[model samples]
Target: MNQILPLELPNGISLEIKREDLLHPFISGNKFRKLKYNLLQAKSEGLETVLTFGGAYSNHISAVAYAGKEQGFKTIGVIRGDELGDKITENPTLKFAQDCGMQFEFVSREAYRLKTEPDFIAKLKDKFGSFYLVPEGGTNEYAIKGCEEILTDKDANFDFVCCAVGTGGTISGIINSALPHQKVLGFPALKGDFLKDEIRKFATNQNWELVTDYHFGGYGKVNEELVQFINQFYQQTQIPLDPIYTGKMVFGVIDLIQKNWFLDNAKILMIHTGGLQGIQGMNTILKSKNKTLIEVQ
Candidate 1:
């Protein structure tokens, strides 16, 4: 866990971040937690292949590829945007996945939206044969089970447990394991209250809620201000944060602190769910748009 030093609030609020991002160099953070049992289950089921879905620069796509390689399972990534099929070299995430031996099945955005539909899944099964399926963002019962282990008994001392919400898996797991007195605050990477419903499906505890004010537009969207904040934050703490998830959560948490959202002397624990690998891909987009790039190490 890394203690945040720059956030000097008036109410004596202290923030400690769990560096789940440091859990692995590639499959880090919630991805690491989410994939643990799913991979084990695949092995136990005698599955020789793992298949999942994601977008162009999806951390899930990249992590699943690496995890599959490490576990000796053939992996296939059903990537959204068929146009991306011809642009693999330009995308860091896809290129890394390819190097890790993950095959890609690029589909239209419309088709990708039907990923949960039986017909679409049947088509994939027909093409890939029998494979262990992991949903986009790696959220499932096993994923949630793995995530529930994120918070340890030692974390019971904190009054608030905060994390970036994506696909609702990580926070759901945190919500399930959090101490009764610890309120789990989720800062969503995407724009919507729909996440609350999704989170409720897995997180049985009522101690968690979403703070939805800092998306910077929506998923995979960013502006100059957010870019500057992420870069400056890296400079200040020597910690690299991915703009899509952790950066937004940290920004919101500090903003909330400035607004005196928590009581005096509250201890907040932020889960640094890693998406750092996506920075290179995001920087590529930022550079083309003539925007400030994420300062990656």
Candidate 2:
């Protein structure tokens, strides 16, 4: 559902958020869209196990764990940071995945860097039996195919579509389905130019551009200001945005509006690709450092 934000903006600019977060309790937002067909294909191939990769607090990991279990497939998560293996109980995301019966293979950060290598994957297959592989962030062709369904006819009226970019999958799908006159703006959570090439590999349209200024340092890095903004936004809108993606994108959109970057009377639709599951983990970190926490109800 598209929810109109009650913010008063200059230039008659209108804002609405596509609450993809409400799609499911666990497999919500783009995660649901990205995994829809991939899981089906796995089942079609008579696969009984699904293996994927992520970090300690990855939303993809959490979603895949619950979704795989719900779909009657055993799940394995190849996690970065070998140290996290022993810290599972203290980490909400890892603990939740474990509770969902997702087995984990913790690898060193250096070894995790070889995740895309064929030799590394061959070693994994040698260690574990044959299983369906869902790449990190779930951005394979099948995943993108699923993400393309995010925008429907009801969204056609918007002048611009906005979303947070991670692995470039969600934005690529939005770019594919967007109208010719509508522009798609992607706010990448990480600081890098490589995402453009990643998006190009899947996106067939030229209507989208990346707004790279709002990462607030890099992936998984947040400050008090961002925490405050997220808290305030939720208090006002009653919409909880995960700090990693949607929060940053919404901050960027509102900042751009204040700067008068968009034309007058433009209507913007933002995709709330859910990562709310990570909030508990993030809040745990914030508390350790005595930083402002993201408010949740």
Candidate 3:
């Protein structure tokens, strides 16, 4: 539970990465905060199983699998995609998952969205026998409680706090902790203008703004510039960022800084929401010439 680990920026700004991603190899990153409330509700209900949804590279699904394994609960991930992919090879998140002995169930994208269906839950209950369902990102009341624990006892010198807003849990928690004088900014990873409405529907905030410009090509989509930024960021700072969620947020943060959005000496702590495992597919998609480009004879 070590919080507020500090690092300094090149421009004489003192910053911290808020080592939440180091919390657990499996339950790593902000996903833990989002899942905390749902986990408690499951225990209170005497449920021995937990089910959740996510895409092929969902940070939420990975977190749930790890949490269930660590807590000794039967974990099932309702993955959205065609039922394919090698589960044997460990991608980072799944490696810890396999270690914890979590189970997975693959469903088509259509079925995964019916997460709230009575028949769907009933089917899961029939198969798994009395389990709790954690919504996609595990963002709920307990997530807020877990996130509320994040900003405790930090340096009082910070001008503002910034983070990637996916499910709105982390930003909401920061908003709760910020004083009336402080400002909370969320750079969204979701595509289009629909995310603002989704933010309005789920989050407990009226002041937070969603910066839609930096999400790259939408959730889980990236391009050359983002890849270069990650490479440069790692070479310079030794910090690796996952492209889909946290990577874009980091890029957005840096851009905002360069534009003088924050005060010259403002202290901004960027949360490194861990998706290190998803790098597999991202690398697969990226075709930098430096990576071994042998000409076919």
Best by TM-score: 2
- For residue 155, what is the lDDT in candidate 1? 86
lDDT (Cα, tens digit) per residue for candidate 2, span 1-297: 999998989999999999999999999799999999999999999999999999999999999999988999999999999999789999999999999999999999999999999999999999888999999999989998998999999998999999999899999988998989999999999998999999999999999999999999999989888999999999889999999999999999999999999999999999999999989999999999988889877
Measured on C-alpha atoms, candidate 1 has an lDDT of: 0.91
Question: What digit string (tens of lDDT, one per residue) describes model 3 on residues 213-280?
Answer: 89887777677788778777766666667777777888898787677677766777777777676776
- In model 2, the clashing pairs are none
Off by over 4 Å in 1: 4-6
TM-score of each: 0.98, 0.99, 0.85
Given candidate 3, what's the lDDT at residue 19? 61
Worst 10 residues of 2 by lDDT: 288-297
C-alpha RMSD values across all candidates = 1.0, 0.6, 4.6
Score candidate 3 by lDDT: 0.70
Best candidate per lDDT, number?
2
Candidates' lDDT values, in order? Answer: 0.91, 0.95, 0.70
Badly placed stretches (over 4 Å) of model 3 are 1-14, 85-99, 201-205, 287-297
